[model samples]
Target: MKLSEGVEAAIHCAALLAGLAPGKTLPAAALADYHGVSASYLVKHLNRLVAAGMLASVPGPHGGYRLGRPATRISLLDIVLAVEGPEPAFRCGEIRQRGPGALEPEAYRKPCGINVAMLRAEQAWRGALRAARLADVIAGYEAEADPRALAFGCAFLERHQRPGSPLSNPE
Candidate 1:
């Protein structure tokens, strides 16, 4: 199943936040700029992440966003659920009972095999996402990123980061 564009944005933003030093936050504008996305649109997805408890919002001049928990503790599935909700991707419509040759209601008392198989596939997809964590994505990225580039990124983020701000140090 194809995920919405917002899901892709949320995942990338989460990973970027995961790379920040503890207590450091990146403003939504910066996140939008970094990804070349619309700030307002991105904020909608960010809010979803906030509501899901995957990310926390810090309000104020120095306020932006930060992970609500450790990267390792947040799964891809958590982000997916946050952006997409918990509805199963494959919704079974009981198509087996809709046509002219449809089986009698009593004849098909059990769940349709097609429906069951689809549900199983959806479960497997969810399981794969659940097995992945933000930290895993970051680790893989850092492994492949050039050392100079990585250092530059850390420096850039640090320069833009607001420290000791009231919102930055959330209670």
Candidate 2:
């Protein structure tokens, strides 16, 4: 199943916030600028995340958006479901019942192996995504990501991390 570009943007935006100092936040404009995307459209995905309880919208001068909980508690599946809804990628319309040669017997109404296989594959994909948390992905990347990219992420966050932010690890 093809996911919207917003899925990619929202995932990255969530990851960025995952590293922010606790209570510190980044606005939709900041996230859009980081990815060179349009703020108006990107905020659409952001609002979805907020509604899903994956993000919280803060108000006022010190207000912006922040993770609603720890990164470890937020799975990739959650973000995907938030943006794409809880619909299954594979939709079975029971075409076998509509064709002229369709099976017709009290014992012939079972799902075919092909349909079962497709359903299994979709389940496995969802399982893998659900098992993946942003913290896990970030930790994996930190181990092997390019030095320049790592530096850029750290520096970008450093510039944004607020003093007394709870997200930062106390030195």
Candidate 3:
């Protein structure tokens, strides 16, 4: 199924936060700039992550955003649900009983093959996404990113991170 842009943004933003020093944070604008997303729109997704316990917002002069927990604990499904919500992407309307050639109870009481197939596909999709986590994505990225650049990026965030920022209760 096609996912929204927020899903990509939220995942990337979370991965970026994962690379930061523990307790360090980055402003929404910085995240937006890094991913070339609208700041306000990114904030909306960021808020979802915070509300979902995937990230946290620290308020104050040095206030910004940081991951609420380790990347390994955050799944892609968590980010997907946080932004797009957990509703099934496909909704069955029972159209079999509504068409001009509608079938009788015996034929209609049972689900159509198409519907059953779709449901199974949906279940499989959910299972795959559920098994995928932010840590998995980061591992792939880490494999490709230059170690020195990654180190520099982490150092930059730590050096520039604001002090006394509120820490998120990630439980």
Clashing pairs in 3: none
Record all residue pairs in model 1 with backbone atoms less than 3 Å apart, i.e. clashing: none
Candidate 3 residues 13-130, lDDT tens each? Answer: 9988887655557888888877889999999999999999899888877778888888889988889989999888777887877878987767776677777888899788888888
Ranking by TM-score: 1, 3, 2
Per-residue alpha-carbon lDDT of model 2 for 58-141, expressed as tens digits? 766656677877788889999999999998888887776667787665545677676788889989999999999988988988
Q: Give the candidate number with the greatest lDDT.
A: 1
TM-score of 3: 0.86
lDDT of each: 0.86, 0.81, 0.83
- For every model in order, what is the number of clashing pairs? 0, 3, 0
Q: Model 2 compared with the native: what TM-score?
A: 0.85
Q: After superposition, how far is residue 123 of candidate 3 from its true place, in Å?
A: 1.7
Model 2 lDDT, full chain set: 0.81
Q: Compared with the true structure, what per-residue lDDT tens digits does model 1 show for residues 1-171?
A: 789999999999998887677677889888898888999999999999999988888877868888887898889999999999999998888887898998768988888898899999999989999999989988998999899978977776877775524334322
Q: What is the lDDT of residue 63 in candidate 3?
A: 76
Ranking of all candidate structures by their lDDT, best first: 1, 3, 2
Residue 56 lDDT (model 1): 85
Better of 1 and 3 by lDDT: 1
